[model samples]
Structure formats: C-alpha cells, structure tokens
Target: MKKLTLVSLLALFMAGCAKNTTDSPTMVGADRDEHGCIPSAGYQWCANTNRCERPWELAEVEGFDNTPQLFEAFCTGQ
Candidate 1:
C-alpha cells in the first residue's frame, strides 16, 4: 500500500512537471489587433493618425478630453 501511494505521488509530480509546450505565458504584443494596435499596451486604432495610439496620450497631445466619446470624436476628426 505504501509503495502504491509513493508511486501515485511520484506519477502526479512528474505529470505536473510535464507541461504543454503551447501553454506557456503570453508574450507582449501578442494581443495586437488587425491594425497592429496592442490593446494590452493601451493602444487602439486612430483613423486621423492612421495608426494605433493610446487615447489618453493622444488627448494630452491633441488637447481633447480623455473620455471614450471624445477619443472617438477626435480620432474621427469631429
């Protein structure tokens, strides 16, 4: 019975050590959108700039409110 328990525990430990190759941690920029906007890095598609940009940063630079509506308005050149 002890041998069986020991073998079971060892099997579980080895199984835990055996991880799936594809189950690794996600790399940065892996969540980029179709326009290459990395949402994880706070980037979104900006039509006016024709590229990905962080809304808050764009608001600060372009003198617009940092709200989602304003971001959309500004990016759409409203």
Candidate 2:
C-alpha cells in the first residue's frame, strides 16, 4: 500500500510540473482577438499607458499599457 501511494504521489507531482500552454498567448505579433490585448502588426498594447504602440514608440505614454508576459512567451515559441 505504501509503495502504491508513493507511485501515485510521484505521478501527481510530475503532472503538476507539466507546462500549461493554454495559460499564455501563442505569438508576439498575433492578432489582438487571438491573444487578448497583445498587439500585432508592429504594435504593442500598453496597459500602463492604456494605449497601443508601434515598435518604434516607447511604452511610456500617458496611458502606458503593457503587453502580457505571455505575449513575449508567444514570441519565444516556448
């Protein structure tokens, strides 16, 4: 019985360690509808500034918004 419990616990722990792909967006420049507020087409949704920005622009506008880390994750492609 102890051996079975240990095996079960190990399996559960491994399962918990698995990466959750659904938690993050898919790519950096994907459509906004697909990846929430992350902008596409050389744009980024700035949460702090509460606005969109082109790559040339900084993220320090009045409504400076921020793209989710997931957006960068998507860019990294896991």
Give the top-scoring candidate (lDDT). 1
Tens-digit lDDT track of model 2 for 1-78: 999999999999999999877966667655574325555566665444445545344523323344545444333444
What TM-scores do the predictions have? 0.77, 0.32
What's the lDDT of the predicted structure labeled candidate 1?
Answer: 0.92
lDDT of each: 0.92, 0.56
Candidate 2 runs further than 4 Å off: 23-78
Please report, as a residue range, the 10-residue window in candidate 1 with the lowest summed lDDT. Answer: 19-28
Where does candidate 2 have its weakest 10-residue lDDT segment?
Answer: 55-64
Query: Candidate 2 local accuracy as lDDT?
Result: 0.56
